[model samples]
Target chain A: MSHAEKKARTTTDEYELIYWPRLPGRGEPIRLLLEEAGASYTDTAHEKDGIQKVVGALKPDFDPGKDNLPGLAPPMLRCGDLFISQSPNIMLFLGERLKLIPGDVEINKYRVNQLVLTMLDLQNEVHDSHHPIAVSLYYDDQKAEAKRKAEDVRNARIPKFFNYFELVIGKSEGPYLLSEFSYADLVLWHLVDGCLYAFPKAMNRQFEKSPKVKELYDTVAKRARIAAYLSSERRQKYDNGIYRYYEELDE
Target chain B: MSHAEKKARTTTDEYELIYWPRLPGRGEPIRLLLEEAGASYTDTAHEKDGIQKVVGALKPDFDPGKDNLPGLAPPMLRCGDLFISQSPNIMLFLGERLKLIPGDVEINKYRVNQLVLTMLDLQNEVHDSHHPIAVSLYYDDQKAEAKRKAEDVRNARIPKFFNYFELVIGKSEGPYLLSEFSYADLVLWHLVDGCLYAFPKAMNRQFEKSPKVKELYDTVAKRARIAAYLSSERRQKYDNGIYRYYEELDE
Candidate 1:
């Protein structure tokens, strides 16, 4: 059996994902990867006092103990004694373990990481579209700046990224990035899914230019595991998280 | 001989660095790693028509060829037939080849990557302090917003990140994040060096609280190769690049 199939049969939860409750923020991508891999894991988001557990994990004055440095932010993955943070980092680690990677391990891993990082960069840009000035500040406070910023995100940034990906998967051997179903695909799919929700009008326009991306977005969603997970309660809705829907910000 | 030592003797410039001309920007960390590892490589920044080379590499419609893809931005590294981008992704790739990572490769690589990504996150935040509203907009156009953003960067963000590093390096095996001087240190050092250049007064205050980070910052600077590179013309000055020193935004 393949590594993923072996992981699927395991009943014991090995990976413990710790993140915030009730939002698909950065944690969503990791959750999707785990779900798609059939990797047995427990999310703190589903646990009792999940919010407090996450809040306590963010102590400013924490120790970086043996084989374990505390996560600077949420979406931290703990496997056995090892604990790590950063959505991309967690995914990179899991991608190798869950056999989500395609081609030779040596060459394609960095490509996978590069694409994931680029997607996150766009994700951050999308987040900034609603809070142009400061993340700490409220949307009501930076509404004007956000509107202008959203204009750049929708008009220039989205098309540039979409066209790049559309051209990428078009020429790639298969529909997914790197011509295989990898974690990079999950990251892009999640970001595009968020983008479509946050800026439905703008995304509809961008999607027309990026039919491949739209198709890939649909392809990832239709995967049996991903489909089941999305309809499941574990999948959090977009609220005031990274991708927010503001009518004024949307074109 | 060690892998790094073996690579040090490689006279052929198999690795070509494609980045902006005359700006450290995101390329500094990659350059530092290459330098410290004593790796032979060519830089497009030093080549004739370097600006055009960097610009042309960023064409959005460029094809993603076999085993080779284009960089979305500057600081793309080309090694042999494989091409990749995203500064952290490039560093992660080079870090392994150059033997810049310490301890077990599997355990430490993710830790190294996570720290590097966090440093880049801070680097992006510092860039945003000056260009909070839009990266496309001129700093003068967003001067008021930049001022407000810089305040939060100095007051809240700087301390939080600095303290985390300070506490981490202090408890780590040595003065480095994971000790033994890896790419994470290089990334953090480059970032701290830039932060110091941009915010002398604020960094001085932060350095007092984060003496370990200050120490690591100094240690990285004193490394023989880094010192030489900093003094040499190869080290680009902080022109209107990512880390710009605006007096009003500084303190």
Candidate 2:
């Protein structure tokens, strides 16, 4: 192909996402973004030899004799020559390219990043709720500790984070976090969706106190693309994902 | 002042960092960047009524009746009109202005951000060692759980994270993460310093297996500006920060 043709092909190339097959975990937010943008992408998690493909990519010699930067974990994205991990970082790259973020009027992009990081913080805490003692240990092994941790998360942390987002939405002029539908809105929707599955009773109670956040969640769910993605077969179920509904851990 | 003169003054303006008065928690990374750049900045944590200043800034009406964008927590940086929280986001803002990051050469800045976020993940895990159950609970109340959590962290997580960093260093031709001094280097130094204090025996043992990381830590400590900052009173001691030395928890 000519140089101009090559550049055009690169710009229009589909993303390849490598994540665990079974869980809609960290990869879900990225998937949501792709779905919302109606972008072309391949989810390696669902493909044949998917797990091995992910494992192979994470190896230093995946490219043979060349030491590529291996990701610490999955939910990695590849587009053209770029291979990057860390969900928020990947989201930022996609957000910029897909125009999911506002114009870079100085700190606007950083504002989006800040909110996404906060969502990640909440997600980490959510994961910790089930694996309070150690990630190496099973939830069954640490059931007592998990129960206690879940109580604190439900009673304290959830309120603090949800209220913060409520205030953010209240402060904005919109049906979104930044007065328009942005990646932060998508991230929050996925997190809240996961939380509802994980802690149905607690989240329902929390939602009662966060009307604005509840509205944002409803609004995001009703988006035509997101609505289609939610009902599609492509949307993976939450089982061993970051958010898991443990009956005893719930209120 | 004329528009040109005003613009010049804005470019050279100092920063105000609002954080908890006591701990060298998330704020340390931001401090390291300022110290390394030899930039003029005020650490709100050190001044009289410092805690109040931080508390006041977090209130929505801190600017009185006008709804200001309140930080969810501290380690917030104020430069001109921008008020941002989250340590890595703050670092990105400073990394740009202070030239602590490399020039934007495609994916270089994202690489820096990815590493910084990884460091923050490690830092969060470090904090959880002491406060396993909840941030609201006292360490004394959760000492048994803390001991168990700390043991797993010492045995598994620390080595995993340290090895990852060592591998990253080995991949680069570096005195730093990106082959030259950058904000990632500063953040790593502060984290290792915190680690050494929090789990001296464990980190000392872990260091034996991670020479490159050890070298990186030692090299960062020896920089003239960083060295000066380390010895200066401005370098707040870690008392109740993210990393704390609990004798029983340590090996």
Candidate 3:
């Protein structure tokens, strides 16, 4: 195959995503990218006995020969021989390859990365609001603290981030974070989708102040591939993962 | 200038770092990279009326013409005409330009970025441990939550991350994260150093298990430019920032 042919054919059947099964968790963003691009990938989270793939990957003492540097958590992706973890790192790699980001200008990739990183940061904040005391402990163990923390995230942080999203989307031509579709848009869409599921009342109140963000969220939902992926059996529900619904915690 | 000259001359005096004044905080990592690269950068935090520059940048409403997309927070950087925020993005740009990472291979850059992002995640966790309830609230207001959160961080999270750092550094040939000097080493070194300052007793106890991490921290501290930079007036204290030494919160 020619070099151009190789560049164009970034997606392959060999791509394997390693993450916990049963909940979409952080892996959904990666899955969204694959689905949108029609890229073939094996999501270990979905397979029978798949969680063993994730747990085994987390086993300490990585062999020096595997080029497997120790990563703290999963959502690791393996394309051919290269294995890497970290959701943003995996997104950057696949975004470039899957045509999920704009091409030609080098700096533009960093621009998309900037927005994605911000959204991911907010995602972590949302997670922490529920697990305020410790991830090692259950939500019941820190329910009181979670109540206070969730109030702050729902009242202040979400609006702050959504406004920034609205401000950024306005700078571009279309509904996407950039003028064209980028992986940042996919991540943003997932964040809003998850937020809506987790805190529907708060997000609905926030949508009033961030109509553009709400519009973009709806726009991404209607995308043919994404719509199919959302309704498919493969898409997991929000459970004990990052975005959880506890009636007491929600406004 | 020729292409070779331009490639080698990555350190332009024109690079301006925009951040808060009087505290090393998040901006210090960026400063560490610039100092190690011997890249002359104007830190907006230190100049006369410099805080104004950072404050002005934060004021809402981004201009489409400026290519200034809305960033949630700074350490915004300006190099030539390209203005960007988010510490990791700036580091990646400079890491490539200044040869901070091993060159000629594209995938290697992603590897270094992976480590840097993890360290930054720890940095945020350290910050959250202090202001557990909300970033908007004062430490005193969240003192109760902070104590519980800080204990979990000091005892569980820090060791988990430090061990991972040790594991990754062991994969390489030498003291640096990837054989030779890379930005990942600078980030890891700063993280360990900051933890030592913030949670001296805890870090000292943890260091016994993470001897390699301790060694790498010492190695980075002694690098000529870093050593010089640390002693210089440019290096700020860790007061009212991410890594704070609260005696009650420590041990």
Tell me the lDDT of candidate 2. Answer: 0.82
Q: What are the per-residue Cα lDDT tens digits for candidate 1 across B21-51?
A: 8778888899998887777788988999888
User: How far is B195's C-alpha from truth in model 3 (Å)?
Assistant: 0.3
* lDDT tens digits, residue span A1-251, model 1: 36666455344449989888888999999998898888889888899988887888788655435767777788888888788999999999888887787779778888898888889999999998998777788988888778878988988888888887886787675578776678888888899999988989999988878888988899889887889899998888888899999887786
Q: List candidate 3 stretches off by more than 4 Å.
A: A1-10, A64-66, B1-10, B64-66
Prediction-by-prediction clash tally:
0, 0, 0
Tens digits of per-residue lDDT for model 2, B52-76: 9888877755551222255688888
Q: What shift in Å separates residue B243 of candidate 2 from its native position after superposition?
A: 0.6
Question: Each prediction's Cα lDDT score?
Answer: 0.84, 0.82, 0.84
Q: Model 1: C-alpha RMSD to truth?
A: 2.5
Task: Tell how far residue B109 is off in model 3, in angstroms.
Answer: 1.1
- Candidate 3, A79-179: lDDT as tens digits: 87678888998998888878787754487888888899999989998998899989999999999899999999999999999988988887885588888
Error of 3 at B3 (Å): 21
State which docking tier applies to candidate 3: medium
lDDT of 2 at A21: 90
lDDT of 2 by residue, A75-160 (tens): 88887777778899889888877667765634577788889989899999999999988988988888888888999999999999
Query: What are the models' TM-scores?
Result: 0.95, 0.93, 0.95
User: Which window of 10 residues has the lowest lDDT sum in candidate 1 chain B?
Assistant: B4-13
